[model samples]
Target: MTIDLPEYPFPQPTALEPPAEWAELRAKCPVAEVRLASGDQALVLTRYQDVRQVLSDPRFSRLLNADDAARVTANESGGVFGSEQAERTPVGEGHQRWRRLVGRYFTAKRMAAMQPRIQAMAEQLLDEMVAGGAPADLVSAYGFPLPVWVICDLLGVPDSDRVKFAYWSDHMLSLTRYRQDEINAAQLEFGEYIWAHIDAKRAEPGDDLISDLIVVADAEDGQLSQMELIGTAQGLLVAGHETTANMIGKMTAMLLADRDRWEQLLAEPALVRSAVEEALRFDANPGFGMPRYLTEEIEVSGTKLPPGTTVISSMAAANRDEEAFDNAGDMDLRRTPNPHLAFGAGPHSCIGQALARTELQTALNVLLNRLPGLRLDGSPEELPRREGLIIGGLERLMVRW
Candidate 1:
């Protein structure tokens, strides 16, 4: 029996937990049907194995997904990075090329090597937040600033531009929240910003990722076109800060939900890493799933899907799956073999995950040590959440020491 799924951009649940509907679907029908905001149909994969299978399978192509007419609209080109289609490079080999090119610069070794720098930045931000006294909005005081600084410094973006970038990121990533005209306006300004930044790097390169890409572009047989270079920069700039910043605010909010979680982390700094991982798994704020277009007929758990079908693999639901996890609803800091899809998996997995982890771990350690009395200013229900957007996160996180 097929289910007529509820609208996508499913209303923000009052709590941080994944939707109750997801669990019901996972048990009764893992690969249930869904109706997107555009009135287009899709499959929402809720089960852990099924979600992973969809993400891992090459038959489910992102490029093909973008090529669909049903998804393309005035507001979106059905972009994976939440930007215009032409603004990005191709997937498949293009994705591999991106991974290879970026792997050299964003390696785990490179991120590990930058730990001291990341930690120092965290301390500097926290110091200012401490100076501001208590009852500060963590989102602005620490969360937003930390990643914006780190990513801008990395990409060699000017100090003047981070604010503008944040504004653009907010408008652009809000897929359903903003109108088509509003998104288009943002896209235009964002594209202009990236192109200008690229040109600046071309004129005088620096010891940064954009500069490095410029060098690669100047090399013979280099595959990176100017558009691709600009697109890549935009991707790093927007995603680089937006995702990590929200994660920081959300991570802190999650910990503050329970004083025991805070005490446990304060007692053992080593546990901070696992705490970050658990937070990643526990947070289901990125309410909308990444869209993948099917290239061939496929099926999972006795349900068959035809070619050209759209599927929204539910990482939120899968991560909380009872079959894959014990006490699935609980946040367990000590869970071993926890294959959470927080960073996603397969060819299209998040490329800057290492840096994200470093940022998160550093943020957690700094917050706990520096603010002994840090706790939520209000209960979860009293706090507001982002609505009508692809991302799930708090509107503001007020905390005090």
Candidate 2:
């Protein structure tokens, strides 16, 4: 049956605005059909409760490599969706074990301890940006490098190799950008690089996550396989670098889009934490949301979804659902008890969330303290949206102080 479904990433008037379809879908068609970049159809959950349920439930699995699952992209290998690394990721009990191994390093206490270093990195980036003078592209000047440096330090990755990491990440995140061959080559290159790095780490372990994982894996009896080790390193590098990098850019753009928001934070420094949460919840362009494949027949929002169904949970959409938050459209910097799903939900929620939060809070504080005069160099509507990636971000966030 040929279904005339609207495209998955609905058209937006600007980079920082949500698609009109999100509000409409939540209102009338909470569970709506949409076509992906691969031209395959999947059901998207826009309502807060439905999205939360799908993500938190065990039945909606990340096993998108199934033969019957809808491919997320048109690439022959489905980009990151059906990549070997994704396939190698542990599931069920194995997944729980994997999370346990990685989660220990990302606890709130550890992230808090690392805040000073994160703040220093942010300060250095901001100093460099200021040295370059005004009308700078914040995305390039401050946003991208901060998270890259932090993640690289965490993984024992050399700072000199950041350019390559960026390239490999972009290729792996292809939605409609690179050709199949290009994507394949990038993955191969990234895998080879990670393997080589792992070999180096094995010989001389360092005080980093990769080295720590190597030690743990060596001690464990069949707990983390060699492939799992490689997948873990690769996954951390990409997830730790890409999403956070894009978010720093998006978060800054959101604040500067409204001077009052920026002023609000500067006036009440205590609001930094809550403001970051609000920004996460209020983000209109968070790129391709988390995708889950159904393992069995299930009902969501009174709709029955059968086995083999591929459902995309629009966390960004759900974050803005009126039913979930008071004045869902308003950006409340003081919003308390804010339980936004920006890091996702359930067992599969982002493990590095604490680290992400630390980086974000540190970055915002450093910026507000150092450059209270900061303002956008261009209008919000004039900003260009980054294209061809599952994650959404601004191509360039021009700013001045």
Q: In model 1, what is the error at residue 62, expressed in angstroms?
A: 1.9
In candidate 1, position 50 carries an lDDT of 90
lDDT (10s digit) by residue, model 1, range 155-265: 899756778987787676665777777877887899898888888888998999999988877788867767678777877777777778778888898888888888888
lDDT of each: 0.74, 0.80
TM-score of each candidate? 0.92, 0.94
TM-score of 2: 0.94
Per-residue alpha-carbon lDDT of model 2 for 1-401, expressed as tens digits? 78788987787789889999999999999888899887888889999899889878976677567432212321111111112232236888887888888888889999999999999888988889899988899888888898889989999999789899889878877788988788889889998999999999999999999998888778748788888889888877777766777778888889988999999898999999999888888888877776788989889999999999988888888999888999999999999989888877777777777888888888899989999998888789989998887767788988889
Quick one: how many clashes does candidate 2 have? 2
Give the clashing pairs for model 2.
287-392, 288-390
Candidate 2 scores a C-alpha RMSD against the true structure in Å of: 3.5
